[model samples]
Target: MADKPGNQTPNTPDVSESDLREMKVDELREEAREAGVGAVSGMKKEELVKALSEARSGSGGDGSGEGSGSEDDLGAGPDGGKIRRGPESSKSLKYSQEVTSPDEEPEREGRSLVTTHHEVIKEWAEERGGVPATVGGTEHDDHLGVLRFDFGGDDSNLRHVSWDEWFKTFDERQLNFIYQESRTDGNQSTFFRLENPGREDA
Candidate 1:
């Protein structure tokens, strides 16, 4: 007997790899979580798809493959989960390397690095006297909105904030920081941009 069009077994995934690929990274992560694919917070889009596929097929041992470790493997989240990987924002600056730790250095000058590491982000901001900040009047009921870095610029609407506050909001929103250490000419550069891959407008 053939299964009905809308009826499928519990082990059979209704979504396909191509369908998963078309979905945003955040959406993929959510699907992974709902499917009982563990350690998905740090997974990239491809990884999430693979994990989901494996889980659906019931062939992924423990459903903990590569890059599938507890949240502490990367950075601990406020709720003991791994630091999330945001979807690449449309407005994100170009980055050549992905730095997971503060100790990692760029392979060349003017190279852009993307990271969600707290230490790495803090170091990068401090190196150029950048302070955590938020856009004025963008607050939502005591929650900071539109995070930014204040480099002593003339932007009077920027409100300086504590690192704790900034990071709390950062993780809550699942954002990635794109930045460069120097210009292509080897001069100090203050180029940095924050992106929330979870947002359609990000």
Candidate 2:
């Protein structure tokens, strides 16, 4: 049987990849947290699975191993196993790369897919004076340099980084949306959809 939300017991059975696929995003995120994967609550199932799998095998999180492992090799453990991949690497991102905007904006949606247009982002940044800088290893810096998330609640501290660093980590982590909200003063917060919004495949 599937585990209930907020009731994940210590004795929960091993979750398989197929099972993980069937679970809700919140469930997948809980499982990812149990496995010590980072920034998974904001990810799609496939991306969550990949990240959890990477965490299990210690591939992407740390730069330790060499040579790519078998893709078909699902990890073996209490959690559904992860596919082993080559050593994690970083890539460059195009600051001017166009982001696909969503058809509509949902107010107060914690994580919503939005457009990745540069002009749009520039205007938003201008409102805030400059982009939020990615700070040191503080608790708020939990999301690498991609985002500023507050693990405690909805009061997420949105930070900013250079367009270069932002796009690079965005691609590396396979992210696809921005957490949206309306402050008391009637302003907005946004992030470009890093993943191809229209693609079904991971």
Candidate 3:
């Protein structure tokens, strides 16, 4: 059975490829204590693959390939609610690169953000399929940049990357519609991060 957090969410280390390779039953059990292992526990490493398959056989949360909850469930509850909007979502958004602090540069290490984009991301997006995903970037003192994201463009839900490659691009000939995600207001309070913080409406 999966263990639930009881007023405490333990910090789970990132499951590295190296760690997965050498996992033992006892080690897996410990991992379960940290992050519940479910049916994947006690199986020989070889059996791990098959057990994961069984767990996903309508036993886990995601019934559809998309994820756990439905569209209406978005913004409702943290667990079942879909906080991150997908490309196909009607409440999707568009992205534009903005360098906030002049002193802020892209950090290649340390702090990495799991930001989304309007299916317009280039290289990584095209290579990984048109699906929306989070990618890593280097934040530095002089250049803290974000991958531009938005909705509607080339296709019903597609994006464009700028030629600079570091920035997002849109085809001059084609245009549709774009919307940005709304963050909450106030500090310590969860506010939707405005695309351009300097922008007044932002």
Best by TM-score: 1
lDDT of 3 by residue, 143-173 (tens): 4233333322344323334333332211211
Give the distance in Å from residue 106's predicted Cα in candidate 3 to where it truly belongs. Answer: 50
Please give the CA lDDT of all the candidate structures. Answer: 0.68, 0.40, 0.28
lDDT tens readout by residue for model 2, 114-200: 333332333234333445344345324445543432222333355445554554454454433332333435555543323433333
Candidate 3 lands at a TM-score of: 0.18
Q: Which regions of candidate 2 are displaced past 4 Å?
A: 1-113, 138-146, 149-161, 181-202
Question: Which parts of model 1 are misplaced by more than 4 Å?
Answer: 1-95
For all predicted structures, in order, the TM-scores are 0.56, 0.27, 0.18
Q: Against the true structure, whose lDDT is highest?
A: 1
lDDT of 1 by residue, 38-101 (tens): 6565456788788887777667634455554433243433433223444545433343487765
Q: Judge candidate 3 at residue 122 and give its lDDT.
A: 26
Q: Candidate 1, 93: how far from true, in Å?
A: 7.8
Candidate 1 weakest lDDT stretch, 10 residues: 74-83
Lowest-sum lDDT 10-residue window in model 3: 168-177
Clashes in model 1: which pairs? none
> Candidate 1: deviation at residue 81, Å?
12
As a whole number from 0 to 100, the lDDT of residue 155 in candidate 3 is 43
